[model samples]
Target chain A: MDVYLPIAEVSVNAPLLLALGALVGFISGLFGIGGGFLMAPVLVFLGIPPAVAVASQANHVVASSTSSVLTYSKAGSVDYRMGGIMALGGAVGALFGVELFRLLRLLGQADLVVAVSYLLLLGSIGALTLKESLTTILARRRGEPARREPTRRPLWLYGLPFRVRFPRSGLYISAIPPLLLGVFAGILSAIMGVGGGFILVPAMVYILRMRAAVVVGTSLFQILITTAVTTVLQAGRNQTVDIVLSTLLMVGGVLGAQYGAKASARFRADEMRAALGLLILLVGLQMGLSLFLRPDDPFALAPGGAG
Target chain B: MMVPPGPPPMDPPALVAPAPEPPGPVVVTQTPTISAALTNSEIEVDSSYAGASLVLYGAVFNPGDDPVDVVLVVRGPERPVRLVRKVRVAGLWLNSRPVVFEGAPAFYVMASTRPLSEIAGFGVLRRMGVGLDHIQIDAPDEARTVNLYGVRDVVISRLGEDYLEWRRAVIRLKERDGLYRADPSGVRFVDPGLFRAEIVLPPEAPTGEYRTEVWLFQNGQAISVRRNTIQVRRVGVERWLHNFAFFQPWLYGLVSVLLAGFTGWAASRWFRRT
Candidate 1:
C-alpha cells in the first residue's frame, strides 16, 4: 500500500519511513555529519523510486540541519558571514552540476558515472573519518596529550577579494575558501540529492580550520539554503518533487533531530566521528556488492502491454 | 487633480439603391474525396451465445469537406443489433468505439455511411466476459420463504472460490436481437434448497461442450449440485512483452554511485590544498 506524506506529496510507507527518518536523525544528531548518505540508500532499499528518494533525502537534510544549526547557534558557534559566502558559491555550483547531470543522461552514461563515483567517494570519506577518530581515541588511552598547533592560514584565502572577519571563528580569511566549498557542495547536493553537509563539515573543520563548535553550525546553515534551492529547482524543472513523501519523512525526522541533538550532547566528539565513519563504510560496501550481483529479472511486464 | 471635458459629433445613416451585375462564368470544383483506412479490417467472435460481453473496435478517417456518419450492425441467431452510428469529421481520426447489446449467439459487424461516403478503417473485435443475469431460488418444503434483497433472516451460504461455481445461478436464454443484457446485481436468495442462476448469452459464447458446478446451501448445510460443460472459441494473442524501463532499481544504484564518486573526487582534490 502507498501512503502519502503531508507536505512532500510523495507516496511511501508510513511506518518504515518514520523509522528510517528516526534512525538517520539519531545519527545526524549524534555525529556532526548530515545523514544524507545513509538516508538516500535506505530510501532506495525501501522501494521508493530512486529520483524521489534522492530529492526527498535532500529535503530531509534541510530540516535536519535546521534543527542542529539552532543548537549550535545557541552555543555561539556559527560563522554566519563565512557560511553565507560559501552558500552563495554553492548555489552557482549547483546550477552547473544540474547541467552536467542532464548532459550525462543524454549520453546514457549516467549509470556508469554514478556507480563509480559512489564507490570512490563513500569509500574514501568513510576511511578517513574512521582512521582519524580511531587515532584520537588511541592517543587518549595512552594518556598522550592531544597535539594542538596553529598553522599559517592559506595564502589564497587572504589574497581573495572578499576579506571578512569571523569573530566567533576568530579568523580573518578571504571569501575564496567558503565560496569554493559552497560551489562544490552545491554541485554534490544537486547530483546526489544530499545536503552536502557530510562534505562541508569536514572541509570547514580541516581546510578552513574553523573550531569544531562553529564548523557544524556553518555547514548546516549553508546546507539549508543550498538544498532548499535544489528542492525548488527540481520541482519546477522536472516536476519530480513528491511533497507527500518529504513531509512524512520530515515529520519523523524533525522529532528525530530533537532526540538526536539531545543524545549527541552526551557523546564525546570521537565517538560521533567513529559512528559516522562506520555508517559511510557500510553504504560504500553495499554499493560495491550490487555491481556484481545478478539482477533478479532482466525483463518485466510494463504498462500498455498486451493482456 | 483637475477634470477635462471633450465633445464629439455623430453622423446619421443613409440608404441607397444599387444596380444588379451581369452573370459571370461559374467555376465548379469537385468535392474533395474523403476516405478512411482500416489498419486491421477483419475480426471474429466465438461462442457468442455464452454468458459473455463482446466488443468490436475500428478506426475511421474522414478526408472530405463534409462529415461522414458510420453505422455498425451485428447479425446473430435471434435478431440484428445496431451497435453504433456516429459522424466522422473531415480529417484523420482513430476510433476504438464500444458496442454493448443484449442476448446474441454469434454475430458479425457491418459498417456503412448514412449518405454513402467513401471511408476506410481497421481494428479488432474483442470478446469480453459474459454478463450475469438475475438469480432466483424457492423455499424448501420445511423452511419459510426467505428473500435476500428485501427479506430479513435469510441465511445465504458463502460463495465458492472459483468464479464459474456461481454460474449455477446464471439463467441462459435464447439469443434475441443479437444481444443479451445481463443483470449481475439481480442475484439473490429466496429460500434454502432450490436455487436458480441467470446468465445472458453472448454472441461469442462457445458453440458446445461446457461444464459448470454450482453449490447450494441452507443453515450451514451443503446441498446437491453437479458440473456441466459448454464449448467456447478463444481469440487474440495470448502473451506479449511489457516494457518497463524506469522502474529498474539497478539504474538508480548505478546513477547514485557515479554522482557520489564525482563529488567525492572533487571534494578530496579541493580539501588537499587547504
Candidate 2:
C-alpha cells in the first residue's frame, strides 16, 4: 500500500519501508551493531531526500539502543561511568563536527566528505574484524588456545591523564583514552550520520581494554544519549526528522531485532563475522561506486538558496 | 530618509488598474471568455492518502466560426530547488557547479485540446509564461554565494547557457516524480464550446495553494485568461505533525526522542516473555 510521509513530503510504498526496517533490524541484532549507516543509504535510494534519510535513521538508532540497553542493564553488564564520561567528550566533539559540517556545506563538499569518510571507516573496520575472526577460527582448528584478549594495558593508554576506576568493567585506567575515543567517534557520528556504536565498541575493547560483555551495554548507553542529541538537533535546527517515516520503520525494526537476536545463537561465530564482513563491504562498495563511476545523470538537485 | 530616490520609478493609477484583485478567479476582457473549476478545490490529505487526480471542466465562448483552443495549467506551490552538476576532476566524479532555482513550482500540470506549440508560437507563449521552454525565473543573489567571499555576483552573469542545464535538470527531476507534465492532447472538446482535462497529482504533492489558470487562444494569441486557486492540506495526525514540525520543532524533537526511547523499552518488555 502507498502512504504519504508528512515530513518527507513524499508518497512511498508502505510495505517497502517496513521490509527495509525489518531487514536492517535483523542484521543489527545479529551483528550487535546499530544499523543507521545501512538504513540511511537505503532510505535515500528509495527516494527519501538524503538529509531526511540521515535524520530519520538517527531516530531509529535511538529506539534500537534503548531496547538493547534495557536488556544489557538487566543482566548487570553496563559500565555507566565510562558511558557518561565518554558522553561528555562526545558532546564537545559533536559541536565541533557540526561546525565543520556547516563549513563543508558552504564549500559544496559536505556530501562527498561524509560519503568518503564513511567508506573509509566501514572498510577498515570490516577488514580488521574479518582478520581477527579468521585468526581466532584458525587457532581453534589448530588445537591451540584461542589467542586471549589483551589483559595487559597498553603503555600510552595507561599513562594518560584523568585516571578513574570502572567497577563494572573491572578496570583502573586513565579516563582520557576512553574520552578521546568518544570524541573521535562522536565526530564520525556527526559527519557520517550514525550513532558511532560500531566504531565505539571496537575502541572500547581493543584500545581502552574494556570487557567485551560490558562494551555492548556501555555502547548502547552512549548511543542512546548521542542519538537523542542528534534527533533533537536535526529536528530543531535542520528540520529534517520525519517522525511518520521513523514510526513506520521502528514498528518493524523492534520486532525484527528480537527475532534476529533469537536467530543469532544458531549461527557459528566465524560464519557470522564473515557475513557481517560481507555486508559492510557491500555498503562500502555501494557508497564508493558513486565517487568512481560516471553517474547516469550528472545533475542533482538540493533544496537551498534557490533563485 | 524623507527624500524620494527618483520620479522615474513612480507611476500613477497602474497598481489599481487590474480590477481590485479578487480573492477568486479573475477574467480577462473578451466575449470568448474562458472559465474553469477543479473537481475538488481542496484536497484533504490524511494518513491514508496515496495520491489523487483532479478533473477540470470549463467552457470557452466564441461567436466566430474559428475554433478557439483552451489550455489549462494547474501549478502547485513554488519553492527553491538547488541543482548540482558532477564533473570528472582528476579521475573522480566530483560535484563542481551549484545552482539554485528560486520560485520553482513544486508541481505543474498542463492539458490542452491540442499541443501547446501548435496552438501558439514561441514568442506568445514565452511572454504569457505558458510552455516549459519559455517560462522565466528570477535569479537570486545568494544563489551565487561562493565559498570565496571575493567572487560573488560575477558568477551569475557568467552563468549564461550553462544555467539552462540546471533548469532542464529541475524539470527532468520533477517529471520523473510525476509532478510536472505538459500533455499535448490531454484536453478534449466534448462538443463545441465545452472542454475538459484531467490532472494527475502524485502522493508527494506538497500542501499549499495551487494556481489554476485557463487560457483561451485564437490565431495563436491569448484572447482571454482566467485564473483560479485550489488548496492542498493535511488533516488528522498528518496535520498535527506538519504543524508541529514547522512551528514547534524543538518540542517535536523532544517527542521524537521520548517516543524512540519508549518504543525500545516497550519492545524489550514484549519480547522477554517469549
Candidate 3:
C-alpha cells in the first residue's frame, strides 16, 4: 500500500492518493475550473511538502486540461488566435510570478502569502458566485428576465493602444485588455500553483465579454499551456515535482472526470453554482481559521529551504 | 545492569577494578573497552522500500565483575534548521519571528538500557554530546542571542536566552514527523557484558550517511566510546529519477511535462474510443 514518491522522498498510501485525485478531478469536471486551487491545499493538508504539492499539482493540471482541450477543439469552441495571444502574455507574466514566488520563499514568508491569498481569493470569489446564483434563481421564480446592462466598455481600456479583432468573440477591442487579463491570471496561476481557470473563465466572460461557448474551451486551451509552462519551470528551477505522485493522481482524475462530466447535465446550472460556492466558502473558512491558530511546533527543516 | 553467574571474562589478568576519578592520573586502569557493529552497513532504497530496522550489537570488553551500561546514538546528516515563532497580531497568528539553528542533524535516535540520567552524569553526557539537551548549536559569533517580547520589529529568536525553548521545539517537530526518538529502555542485554539496540529508520528518512556511536559507562561515568557509520541511498528507478532531478533538472522537467501530456492525451483517446 505504501509507495515511495521519488521527488517527495516520502512514503504515501497509494489508494488514498488515488481517492484524493478522484475527488479533485470530479470537481474539475463538474465546475470546469482547473482545480489547482483545490488540489494544492488538499495536498498540503495531507502532509505533502508545500513545494512538492504545488509542483506535482501543476503537472496534474496539465494532464486534465489536455484531455478537456481536445474535446473542446473537436466541438469547434476553441479560439486558437485569442488563446495564442493570451499565452504569449501569460508566458511573460508566469516568469515574473516565478521570481515573486522565489522572493517570498527567500523571505520565509511563502506559507503566509499562500494562506492569505487563498483566504482572500476564495472568500471573495465564493461570495460573489453565491450572490449571483441566488439573484438569478430568485429572478426566475418571479418570471423576470435576468438583468442585462448595456455593454459599456470602460473608457480607459477602450483607449489603450494595439487594438486587435477577435472574430470568434465578435469584438474589435484593444489587445491590451485581453493581454493584461492574461498576465494577471498567469501571475496568479504561478503564485497560487494552479491553472488559473477559475480566474480566467470569469475574466474572459465578463471583462472581454466573450461568448459563453468560447469562454470555457478557450480558457481550457490556455490552461493547458500555462500549467504546462508551470510544470516545467517548477521542476527545472525548484526541482519539486514528483512524477510518481502526479501520475497516480492523473489516473484517478481521468476516470473521475468521465463520471463527473456525465453527471453535470443532471443538475441545474444555478444549483451547481450554489454547490461550488458553498464548497469554496467552506475551504476558505478553514484556511482563514488556520491563520489565527498557533502551530504546535514551529521549527521546520527544509532541504531546499530559504537558500 | 546484571552479570549472570557464568564463567568470568576470559581475560582475567587484565581485569582492572573501578577507581575514583583523578586529575590527569592513570584513568586507563578504569577504562571500559567497547565494540559495536550494525546489522546492515548499507541500505538500498527501491520502489517497494518502506523502512528498515537496524540492529547494533556491542559488548563491554572488560566486564571486571562490574555492572556497566551502554548508550547508543544514531544520528543522520547535519543540516541547517529553521523555526518560526507565531505571534497573535490583530487576532491572527502570524509568523512574527524566526530562529535559525546551525548544524542540526536530519535524523537522530538514542536508546539506552536505562534512563540516561541514571546511567551517566550530566557532565559525562555533555562531553559525549549524546543526550538531546546537550546538542551543540553553533551560534553566530556577532549576535548575542536575543529573546522575543515584541521588539521594534519581527524578532529573530536565535540561540541565547530562548535557546532551550527553541531546541525543544525542534525536537517536538522532529518527533511529530517520526524522525527523532528517545527510548530510555530500548537497549537490552542479550547476555552478560553484551548489549544490542534497534535503530528504526522510517521510509521517509533522508538518504545520507548515518553515524552510530556507543558509549560505555561504569560507576556512572563514561569510560570509552566507539562509532560506526551506515550509508543509505536509493537504487533502481528511484535512484535514476533522483539523479536526474538533481543533475539534469531542466531535462527532467521537460520529460515530466511530456510524459504527463502523453498520458493525458492517450487516456482521453482511449476513453473516447470506448
Highest lDDT against the true fold, candidate: 3
* CA lDDT, candidate 1, residue A278: 76
Model 2 DockQ, alpha carbons vs. true complex: 0.47
Off by over 4 Å in 1: A1-11, A159-161, A292-307, B1-274
CAPRI grade of model 2: acceptable
Looking at model 3, how many pairs of residues clash?
A: 0
DockQ of each candidate relative to the true complex: 0.01, 0.47, 0.44
- lDDT against the true structure, per candidate, is 0.49, 0.75, 0.75
- Give the per-residue lDDT digits (tens) of candidate 2, residues A1-307: 8888888888888898888888887876666677887987889888887777877888887887788777778888889999988877776666677567655554456678867876788878877877877787788889898676768878887777777999988888888887887777667656666778778877787777787678777987887777777777778876778998988887778777777766877988677776777677678767877788888888866443321
Arrange candidates by lDDT, highest first: which order? Answer: 3, 2, 1
Ordered list by DockQ, greatest first = 2, 3, 1
True interface contacts retained by model 3: 0.61
Please give, for residues B76-140, the per-residue lDDT of candidate 1 as tens digits: 33221112112123421111121212232333223222211122211111111112222221112
| Residue-wise C-alpha lDDT for candidate 3, range B52-154, written one tens digit per residue | 8989997766635577788888898887676776667898777634556667787888899899999977976776678777655554644444432222232
What class would a CAPRI assessor give candidate 3's docking?
Answer: acceptable
- The regions of model 3 sitting more than 4 angstroms off are A149-156, A298-303, B1-31, B144-157
